[model samples]
Target chain A: MIGSRQHGGGVIAFTFIIALLLTVIPLPEGLRFLRPDWVGLVLIYWCMALPHRVGVASGWFMGLMVDLLTGTLLGQHALSLTVIAYITLKFHQRLRLVPVWQQSLTVLVLLVLHQLLALWISRIIGRPGVPWYFWMPSVLGMIIWPLVYVTLRGLRRGFRVS
Target chain B: MLVSLSVVLMVMDHRFKSLESVRNTLSLLVYPIQLIVEIPGTVTDWLDESLATRRKLQEEVDSLRTQQFMQQAQMQKFAALQAENIRLRELLDSSFEIGEKVLIAELMSVNLDPYKHQVVINKGELHNVYAGQPLVDADGVMGQIVHAGPYSSTAMLITDTSHAIPVQVNRNGLRTIALGSGTINRLELPYIPNSADIQPGDLLITSGLGGRFPQGYPVATVSAVQHDPGNAFASVVATPLAHLNRSREVLLIWPGHTTDINSVVSAPVEASAEKADTEAAPENGEAADNHSTAADTATATP
Candidate 1:
């Protein structure tokens, strides 16, 4: 709504669409253990891009979609994602200023928090609790963070085509 | 405004049935994008299979051939014996047994949450897939279909805490319940007596207790039998007979006109009247009995 491009919000929403697509794509059973949190990845990107508008609420909205899409208890992921967004926004200025390595470390902690929140909610709510495999997404998401942040950050910095 | 929209939609789905049609429509809208993301994985799999060495392929072919030969050797006699058994049963006024109609579906991707035991399959409602369908592999029953999508559906594996399968001791036909432990290929058979007639290597099969699954399909093999002197109930642990890890293809079998007791009771008559829309098949004489049971439960539930 500010001096940003006329199409920024539209493009940002489209990216969320792409993230949803990637989230449901079937990975092989073996590789399924390592599937990254596609929604979390994309949400981080957009939250960083347009923090003021696409903050915790956007995360919660996207999180609700994830729950419905995955057929989980609705609001399970929404609450955790919203919490993640809130913390990210609370320190958005600091996160924005850090170097790539420091930023990656910060994202790892964020992913952990997101997952821990989900784990805690599930535990309290009487859902099945598997061992570390539930946290595999955070590990995979962290591994994917650098590549994603680098590529997307490059697009934002270099490719003004959008 | 967008937050309110999402909230309203979420609430519409959570509290009422108004948003299901919308959810289904929105999910279908993403099908093209879903296909695009899924294509790469499929292509990679095809390439991987095509790239398998001829020697390895030949080994597989040889093993399969030898196995088929062994089966054929038994099948010739078994066919004659089966016909005789069927004839003898007909003479006794017993009807022929009903079998499951199976559709082989590929394991798409597992849910991102390790805590939940759910997976998506390539086949969906588009392929006659539906809720209440039993998922299995060559080995045994894995789980049931809890949600059905258009192009892709989700399966909750038996190893989930939310899942429960009725099982029986194959040796003595003693009925028991198998509940999932949320880990891959594990289940807990809780509340059995210390003196229960179970052994470490005993095989468990679908007891058809709940009628959700067909009777007699293998469920699991008891891995541990903990009989404590102090505790009255022995703690039994078993691994699911289905190779939840190794199975590439699984069978999605809904009740196909099964007069199974499970469906008749679990589904309300009001719902069973809607069973044509409910997605389970009725087989056997149970569909006829569905009437009295449905009437009974209608009065039973408060």
Candidate 2:
């Protein structure tokens, strides 16, 4: 049982690393707004699947990584991701009971909340206002939710993460 | 608890600016992930290089040789001009020297935050790259390094909304500040007066007023100038001469360091060729001359 728990921890870490990689990978100028919030999606998935293991602290850690990698205000992404993890943990029981499509709707709200918090921080720090397209990533993250959900679910069952 | 901790971090970072050491330490842990993401790009570049045919390679070499010959010819005239300028400066009893040491750094292909015009370069404190060091491409000034990590650094492109550079008109030497307009292609000159002798197609070069950037490097070309009677200042727009989106390599310059004229004159051609060899040697040639220029537009405008 201890060995299985260790394996599950490794799997979770590997997935987070992959998500971090996808978060910063370069996309074309036109398609940049369409780049999904891969880290946020993965964090939401983990928080919903194993609330005890992946909660606010994991979200905060990943967010700090995003901030360092992206060169934003040090705590900007940390705050957003912590809030996201908290919300996901709060609703994980109800969210897991629903179908994947309905779970995606919840994911959409979480992603939007994440973006809004980030935007608010940017404003407070005197950054210029973004245009309408700045919110496109949340919408794109919503669309990509089902795919991330199924793949992560398969990996979780295979690894027996719980 | 995590939220409050993050909020405290944000306040420290944005308001007090005291968390640089902490950020750098965290960046060290995050560097491996950055390297992993960069592998696919490096692999594609290698594949492209290895797959090139001999004829294609020969053609590239021939073209490069022809370009080098042309540049060498121009360097002769530049050498003569430099001697004359030095002689004139000496006659005027001035001690301003023009040469600076340059190190080539490749832009890591990570696009961080579309809203923030930041690019990562594979040079850092280990390479003697400091915060606020000027970055330039072959064509013109690119930007300045904002955060210097141990193995990599973050640069704010001149097109970022929060960035501004001191510039002067090449034709008449009318000085002004070029502010980034949050777009890649454009820079805004908000301080130019309606009656200022600036026009479309006038070349803007670094005036060296701020002590942050070296003097006389091309910054942008004035693309449009419009006078609004309602406003006191002219709405001047310039297109940055540096290929901000396209250029893969840039030079980190150490201003006031007197390196060999060959490196300075042939910077465009040699930047890519000698990048691998010069990556290790941190050339601390001389102290930077920080004498402020006559106009202080950088502080006034921004």
Candidate 3:
């Protein structure tokens, strides 16, 4: 069990690294709006799968990394990510029991909440007037939740990440 | 607790300099992740270069050679004009401006936030890159460095909404401020008077009033001028000359610090040994010559 836990930790970190890479990778200007929130999706999955291990603190750390990586205001992403993780952890038991599609709907809410928090922060910093397409990533994140869920689940089971 | 901590951090980061050291330290940890993310793009670029046809490569070389020759001819005229300007400036008893020492840095990442126009370049504090340092491309001014990490730096492009540069109309030397309009292609001159001499197609260059960007770099061209008689100011818009979306490499300039020429020439070679391309040497040599000539004029000024 100890060995499996250690292995699980590595897998989780690996996935987070991949998600970070996806978050910052350059895409065509037209498709940028369609790019899913990869880090938030991965964070949600891990929080749901292992709430005790990947909770608010881990989420905050991941947020800080994202802030540093994207060169945004320090703690901007951290605050949003921490809230998302907290919400996921609070309802992880029920979240794990729901069907994948329903979970995706919930994921949509969380992702939107994540974006809303970031938007609120930016507005407070005096950067307002984002376009309507700002909400596209949340919807795209929802659409990709199932794919992320299945793949992470397969990796979890294969690696005995429990 | 995490929320409050984050809020405190944001306040410190945005409102104070207390978090700068913390940010720099954290950015060092974040550097490897950025480098890893850049690998795929770098690999594809390398592949593209290696896979290009012989005929295409020859054609590119031929074109670049012709372009170089034309630039050299222009440089000859520029040298003559600069000499005349120096003599005239000496007669007027004013300090003459020297050529800025420049280091080339490749863009590591593109637009991080859709709302914020920022790019990461491979050069950083290790190469003496600093915040507020001007960035330029082959065509014109691009942006200025905002955060300089150990191995990389983040630059906020001139098109970022919060950015503004002091500019002058190249035609009449009419000084005004150019403000970024949150779009890559557009910049706004919000304070131009309705009866101002500015018109569409007039070129705007940095006025050097703001010490952040050096003078005389092409910034933008007036694309539209709307005279709203009801309003106090005309709504003038311009398209930035720099290829903000396309350029892969940018030059970081040490403005008015010609004394650092030797360090500028040798620093990048020592810092990023892999990037010690042969192209940099000749460019630095040319810049050094310009600096020496300017220095001579500075001393010769009674």
Give the fraction of reference interface contacts each candidate recovers: 0.21, 0.89, 0.71
lDDT (Cα) of model 2? 0.83
Q: Rate the local accuracy (lDDT) of all candidates.
A: 0.68, 0.83, 0.82
The true-versus-predicted C-alpha distance at residue A92 of model 3, in Å, is 0.9
DockQ of each: 0.33, 0.84, 0.70
Best by TM-score: 2
In model 2, state the lDDT of residue A23: 81
- Stretches of model 1 off by over 4 angstroms after superposition: A1-4, A8-38, A86-91, A98-109, A128-148, B1-25, B29-34, B48-66, B76-96, B109-111, B258-302
Candidate 1, residue B27: the lDDT equals: 56
| Residue B169 accuracy (lDDT) in model 2 | 94
lDDT at position B112, candidate 2: 90
Model 1, A1-162: lDDT tens digits are 344554456656776877887676655566666677778887787677668668887898788778767666556667767877877888888888888678777788888887787676566656655566767777778777878887766765564413
Using lDDT as the yardstick, the better of models 1 and 2 is: 2
The alpha-carbon interface RMSD of model 1 comes to 4.1
Best by DockQ: 2
Query: How high is the lDDT of residue A34 in model 1?
Result: 68
